[model samples]
Target chain A: MIQVKNVTKKYGNFKAVDDISFEVKDGEVVGFLGPNGAGKSTTMNMITGYIDPTQGQIIVNGVDVGKRPRKAKKQIGYMPESVPLYEELTVKEFVRYMAELKLVKHKDLKEETNKLIEEVGLKEVENKLIRNLSRGYKQRVSLAGALIGNPDVIILDEPTVGLDPKQITEIRDLIKKLGKNHTVILSSHILSEVSQICEKVVIINKGKIVAIDTPSNLEEKTKSKNTILVTVEDPNNKMESIKDKLKEADEIKLVKDNKDGTKQYAIVSDTNVDLRKKLFDILPKEQIIIFELKKDESTLEDAFISLIDDSKETLKDNSQTTVEEQEEKNLEKNNKTKESKNKQKEKNKKGSKKEDKK
Target chain B: MWAVLKKELKSYFLSPIGYICIGIFLLIFSIFFYLTAIQSASIDLGNLYYNTAMYGLMLIIPILTMRLFAEERKNGTEQLLLTSPRSVTGIVLGKFFAATTVVLITLIISLMYFAILMYFGTPNLVPTLIMMFGFLLLSMAAISIGMFASSITENQIVAAVITAAVLILPWFLPNINESLAALDLMNYYSKFPAGLLSATEVVGLVSFAVMFILFTVIVLKRRKAVK
Candidate 1:
């Protein structure tokens, strides 16, 4: 179980993640969907205890991350965004080292290391140095590092960012398999992948969560009209009058004129209406040969774009009011500390030295 | 702590850095061995270690400690270390001891010169061993300083330069002010090389190492909020 309660991360005056809260139930796979700089990685880092939240609490598996970092971290296995690994060490050695760092038992270290190496499909390159491996293999090595000790909560930040299609599917399958026994929180830009592997999604925009629900629910909410596409050989120009003939059809739009002398038309109708059967029966009677007939479905991508646009408009209106209030608060806080860090304005830059001097 | 220490030690040997550092120390040791012991026929082993501690350490300590935390930060491996179920103090000590152990290995190899000194005549074993022990303390203090420098930056070159500056700046402090002469760590080591055990020097070196080690841990802990 993971609970992020009102988590906020501030680098100087910039709020990387602003007042975001969410929860992942045990054995559930939650996907974090967001545009770049949306604080997806920052939230995962806080949950893993990698970076501290400015004003919030992250409890992982019942242990507060800030209060008991070691205990909470022990419950989590984090594969960072950049896929960091010891370039000098081989795959097996790196996994063994991670096992040791994770406080895996001395006796079980070898067996655990071997199992993870095989699980991530790095057996052939187990003895090769990590620097010598390809990006996909390096990614797998990082996953193996995270999986060591069989941590209860697996937090993978952009796990499939850079990979071939085959490799992506393999990793997606691996994550789905992991989701069966362990609670997995993964972030990705791939909406279809999220819909496939994740049971629920938390979509964030500009450091705030715009929507949170199952993929189907979000798609359903954004899906306002039902449209069916029909490709036909209507050389008689009879497609335009078909909307008038079919009383159920609201709009008939000529989608495309194929070079093969066929026309595709989209028939938009009222919600909860199926026009495929009506078109199949009526097109043949009108001497219109049907080439293809299918419903136009609204996918997660459409849901994501519409939600992002909605959030943008809301932000534009709120910016005038909220920016002022936040700046006022930030000014008072900066005056108290006399230290506004000039570093880490870039996204995902880890570790800071400004506070170190103080 | 032991895990980081062991991994760091293995990393040194895996990349030829361990051999490079040992080689540099041995090269410096051989020069001093020839200068003080072979040419002048000085039976005192203290002068050789003292000379090496004065010169050989500045060059070797940076190489041993520059990559300790800097490379980890640069390569993003610091995430793995900091996010693990380990305290900041343990991680710092682990790297500190790892660098100190590299110097220790070179010192153990320096015993070959000591074995050669035994061929000519029996130099007092007690003072030589004490001098060797004091050299370890001085190296520990220097390693801590370099480790502290490494923790403050992600660039290995910057960390090395910072460490070299910190180590070299003290040598000239006494020239600027008579009171500042006490800041020179070599002054504290004067008695150790002369076959004498000094409590004040032991305390000074240990405190120096402790202060920097604590600084490293505090730096890492504070970075959690800002990073």
Candidate 2:
């Protein structure tokens, strides 16, 4: 078990990780979600005893990382962000060296090395020097290094960043297998991968954790409206009048017109209402043939974006009342304007060709 | 500590640095062997090791120690070593002893000259062994300095140049003031070449090595917070 209590890391005046607290129970797989520069790597470095936290404490298996580093560090197996490995050593040799570094007893060393090498599926390329191997193989070698000595906690930072789709799945499967026996903590920017592998999600933004819960719970919490997407064949444009018939409908937005003489609309209402059942009943009375109708379920990606946006809004609100507030507020406003202007220019360039076709 | 020491020693042999260092030492030994023993017709092997220690070590010590920590820092492999369960003291000693072992190997190979002298004439074995011991002490001191220089920088060339300058500059400093002779590594090594055992010199060289090794450990430990 890992308990991180009020941990904060600061590099000079800038706080990389503000005061944050969380815990990972034994045999649990927790996913750390954040955008870039959100202190994910810093927190992992502190937990692995690679760096000291500026404040608070990290206790792993009853050993405090700062107070008793040697005992605490022995329990952690960390694969740093870029998969640093000894390039001169062969895969098997590197794993053996890591096992030795972790203070594995002489008798159990060989068996432990072999077991970890096989578990990471590095048997074939075990003899090859790490410099000659591909990125995927190098990643496995690093993972094998982290898995040696059978540590209780395994921390992997951005493990799948540069992998291909097939390699990503293989690594994710390996992580899932590891989660069965060891407490696993992995950080990633990929939302779908997190939702698939993580039993709990911790969302961080701007160096502060915004939410921590199950993946489904996070999705449910961020979802504010009951909405349904409906595609219909409306020749005379009777869709706008249908909103008046169903009093439960708060807004109806025409999403897109399909090429097959049909149009799609988004119906939004109160969270307690089931808009799909009401839409299925009311469409036929207006002589509008229903092509397709489905409830719009919020995904993990939506939850991530909404949480980040909410954090930004709260930050803006807080900064508005402080000294030099006008300057800080103008800087953010200008940055947003420049970003949206660039996006508008890109959209205009793409739509120009479509305009010619029209 | 043994694990790191073993791997470092293996790495020295696996690369050409070990062979080159030993080979150069042997070449220098032969030159001194011809000049001091054969030309003078003296059975004193002490002068042979002394001359080589004075002229040959300045160049070879840097080559052996320059890449010890600099290369690791440059390639980011320092992360692997520092994150391990091994303490900083063990890691520093491991690399220190590994580099010292390369010098020991060279000294062992130089015994071929002693073997040749034994075949032709009976030489004083005790003084020759004393000279070898003194040479080991001097090399350990020089290697520790070089290792400390290596730890402070990531560029191998800078580390090499700094080590060379540190070893060579003290020789000229005695010209300005006689007190600076204590800084010359060769001054401490001079007595053993003349069949004299100086307890003070042995203590000086050993303490010099210990001081630098401790400094290296402290620097590395402090880097964790500052880095």
Candidate with top lDDT is 1
Provide per-model DockQ scores.
Answer: 0.86, 0.43
Q: What is the lDDT, from 0 to 100, of the residue A189 in candidate 1?
A: 95
Tens digits of lDDT, candidate 2, B12-41: 887799899899989999999999999998
Measured over all alpha carbons after superposition, the RMSD of each candidate to the real structure, in angstroms, is 7.9, 12.7
Per-residue lDDT tens digits for candidate 1, residues B1-227, read 99999999999999988999999899999999999999999778999999999998889898889999999999999999999998889899998898888888888888888789889988888898899999999999999999999999999899999988888888898888989977777877999987888999999999999999999999999999889
For A1-358, candidate 2 gives per-residue lDDT tens digits of 9999998888886788989999999999999999999889888888988888889999999999888888888888889887888787888889998999999999998999888888898999989988899999998888888889988999999889889999999999999999999999999999999999999999888779999999999999999998889999998899989878889889999999899999999999989988777777888888999989999999999999999999989977765676377678789999999999999999998899789899
What's each prediction's TM-score?
0.92, 0.90
Classified by CAPRI criteria, candidate 2 counts as: acceptable
Interface RMSD for each candidate model? Answer: 0.6, 1.4
